[model samples]
Target: MKNRKHIVICEDAKTRITINRKWCKGCEICVEFCPQKTLLMEGDKAVVRDIASCNRCMLCELRCPDFAIEVSEGTGR
Candidate 1:
C-alpha cells in the first residue's frame, strides 16, 4: 500500500496545501522555508503544524525540490 498523503485547507478558503508523502524525501526545505512556520518535519515527512498562520505565499511548494508539496489559492468551497 502507498503511504497516505496529507491535505490542509485554510479556514478563510484562500489557501490549500497538499503533501504527497510518496514523493517526499524529508528534505526539510519546505519546513525551513515557510515564513509563517506552518509546516514541520515529523519523523520522515512534512506535516501541517499551523494553518491559521499560513499566508498562502506558496514558498513551501516552490521550495520543495522533490515536488512533494503543492500550494493552491481559491475559494476552497
Candidate 2:
C-alpha cells in the first residue's frame, strides 16, 4: 500500500495540514505542541482529528521531529 496521508483544510479554507503517516513515528510531539489541539494519535500514527479547530498554527509542522507534518497556505484540493 502507498504511504498513508492525512490531509485537512483549515476552517479558513486557505491553510492545509498534511500528516505523512509513513514518516510519523507516533511520538506525540506534534499533538502536545499544537496550541489548537488539531492533531491526535491514531494507533501508531498521527492524524488530523479536528480540522476546523486548526488556527493555522504551524507548531505541529515545526515540532514534528520526523518531518511528518506539514502546514501550507493555499486553495487546497
Candidates' RMSD to native: 3.1, 3.2
lDDT per residue (tens digit) for residues 1-77 in model 2:
45333433333467677666667898999888888888888798887787778877787877789987888874655
Determine the C-alpha RMSD for candidate 1 after optimal superposition of all C-alphas. 3.1
Off by over 4 Å in 2: 1-12
Q: How many backbone clashes are present in model 2?
A: 0
- The best candidate by lDDT is 1
lDDT score, candidate 1: 0.78
Candidate 1 Cα outliers beyond 4 Å, as residue runs: 1-12, 74-77
lDDT of 2: 0.74
lDDT per model, in order? 0.78, 0.74
Q: Candidate 1 residues 1-77, lDDT tens each?
A: 34343433334367677777778899899998888999998899898887667888888888889988887764656
